[model samples]
Target: MFSIKSLHKIIFAISFTALFVVWQWYFVKSVFNFDFLARPILADGFCKDCNVILISLDNLRAKSLLCYGYEKNTAPNLCSFAGKSYLFKNVYTPSSKTQDSHFSIFTGLYPISHGMTVPFTSVLDSNIKTLPQILASNGYTTLFSGPKNDPHLPLDRGFERGFSYKDKGDEPRYWMDNMKKNNLLNRKFFAFLHTYRVHEPYIPQKENINKFYPGGPLIYVTRNDLCKKAYIKLLSQYPDRFKNLKVLNDDYCNIYRDYNTKYAATWNVEIESYLARLDPYWDAFNNLDFLVKKEYTHALYATSIYEMDLELKKFFNELENNKLLDKTIVVITADHGEEFFEHGGHSHAANLYNESIQVPLIIYIPKSKSQIVEKLASSVDIMPTILSILGIEAPEKITGIDLFSSKENKFVLAQHVTANLETIITLKWKLILNGDEKELFDLTSDPEEQIDLSIKNTNISNDLENKLNNYLFRLPKYNSIKSEPFPTWIDEEQRKKLIETGYF
Candidate 1:
């Protein structure tokens, strides 16, 4: 009944439409990174009265947690929670420093965008809206608990903008007791709990330390102390190898000890006591093997993590006892991760490696089914995800997307501003650039990032480099406020504190 010429024309038209659709899909995906199969938002407004608890365990690496596949049961409570929560496997911080990473978490912007790229120096721009500000405006009481006089989260830097109450300590029990006393937990509230308990100068209880490290506290020196001893030993052993050999004499060591004594006088009682034990045995301490010291230091770090896990258990138990477990959404993550002689680095913020960037991200939503999410998430995504879960609108200028509804980011960017280092990571490849230096790693094959494939795989490396450059160039810059200059004594005290914390 159909004409042959008409049938041919119909077939040709159908073919042409199919070709156009294919071309459009490819063009949009390549040009704009369109995701055709993005998942819809799940359970919006499911917990309008739910309280939010954001817990940041400073310097906690994902690999050290049992939930993330660590061999030891370092975090039994977190592991159990992960079994019933959404565990994001590949979450990375935008920066390796405390202030920079936490700013990203609170503001939903990268360090470059938020203008806190330098640790303890660059302040957050006052114009930037934070997660706490948004939640507080929505009738949620906000509270903060962290270290007193924290240089990283200074009040002038906008950290104290939206909190109704703030505690200057890192004890969960104290915070819970205060909440009960004030009756703040009965109302809808957002509480941020931060602790350096897992951070270095790894000092756990003696029993906990002995569990992981059979070696006593004699071998447990701060990473900075160990580095100083190692340097002194290097000078003493290879005096002729250095141009300035005169400074390696016994009088020089005595002079250093005297200077430390003068400096310790300005510090608090606890740090002063710590310095007393550190300076007297430098010569004898330097005699320990570098490898042995490294082993013991790692053990101490593991022990500290284990103890922090116990504290977390107590905090959650109190929540359950108060009948608030089902009414709260708990998010546990870290500002950054710590490095243990990985890539010849002792601590963080000096490099953009995975050991310093990868952190744990666990979101516990009541009545939600537990699952592992393999999506690539950045610290910047945290605020948006929290707001999304609360059914609140995020700021219009935020660079992050909701982790639940949006497609996985094509690449995640990280920067170490002081180091002038930048990295771009995809699902399979990672490219790190420091000025003219470039290193590429196939993450799927070398998760440790030991192999540098930049030379052998120039095409892939160059492509990633181009993408990273484009991404950075497009980010909005903010006017960064510099922190006030500290007085000589205060400067010295903070310097000593940083040194003890292994930041030096």
Candidate 2:
């Protein structure tokens, strides 16, 4: 006989044991199934010809889009023009930051394999075969225009041409100069433009800022940018040696407690930045809608997509005025999305929550018609889909499936790395494997990712964990050994900038 508490404990112990056994059994079975990560033979690869213009909006959230059920009409140009585009309900990037996510986007490989898993890490391994590199070989005159952070320059990511992307206005101009010169060639090849409109500082002009921040879901974006500017300005004055900050966000909380102290003054100047005025509410969900109306929303990105949109609209009007809308495959996507206190986070990189990882994938299908698909796609698949669309054989080394061909989840994989280790996400669930602990979430039931389903669904979670661990193990090792140093995605120029700014 047992007391009530003891009886419950005994039952729990038995349940735990049973779950462990079931998980072990399923873990082996799933890992052995090679069809999960299959190489797709796309028939579309052999039957298409169109001008491809791939544009990625940085840090733009899917839920923010009007097409995806949000209340606001954020992307009117896209919603109205694109006919056969598939807006994948769940498309997650491997990592949340620009460096690793875009590296994965370009290579169809995981961050772990490419060694771009951490921030400020230098250029991706030059030898790694990338999407643009493969596309260039297939007669595409690959041209890209965006912010300096686009590819970190140098190796140029194999694209034939690269532009100097900056945070100042004129994002539209970045591509126009090239567009006018290559307008003829563009009719024959693909031109890519990636924009970063939603990265921090949501930096728009005073008039522009009022439209989104004076009562909205984007208030956080504007306020956060204001704080960052203030902080960065103060950090700029520090010695390079002390400025090398290891912590992702600031860690000097207690230092400013006593504001009257000399030490506090230094930090106060950093923290207490002043602007003319702040908007009513900066986090409005209708921020993009307001932007679309004003036309400066694209300029707020520091690179020009609105201008690009105007150019595109003008080009299309002229084309339809002459007849060429059917000949272009226009796509709009995001590397990752900005976090406006969604998970008590600021930038992408620290964690892999849905708001930060979920990106919009809309392609205004060329000549044909675009329709939204209810399938879950990964950013990795975008490159292969592009290759297939243009009738090109995807390179042998790539691991993405042609999404248009395979509408099912044979298991879409996503990974991310912070200071310690990496995490992996799948369709059914997400398994985060840090050194000593494992976090599991059943994404279907819990989209917010609030519950740790690992213990509750040990059998399924453990199986997912094994696959994630094994997948990470396959990434390229820097040293000849199994483990080496932590990842640093910053380039030499960026490193110098960091050093000068006292950010190690």
Residue lDDT tens for model 2, 187-299: 45566665544554455444443333343223333454444443454455443523544324543332222221444312223223321111212333344554342333323
Q: Residue-wise lDDT of candidate 1 within 154-268, one digit each (tens)?
A: 6557887788888766865566865665567779999888888876556577666777666466554444444355346444644453333343443444434443344443333
Clash counts for the predictions, in order: 0, 38
The TM-score values for the models, in the order shown, are 0.82, 0.66
List CA RMSD, all candidates.
7.7, 14.1
Model 2 root-mean-square deviation:
14.1
Best by TM-score: 1
Task: Let me know the TM-score candidate 1 reaches against the reference structure.
Answer: 0.82
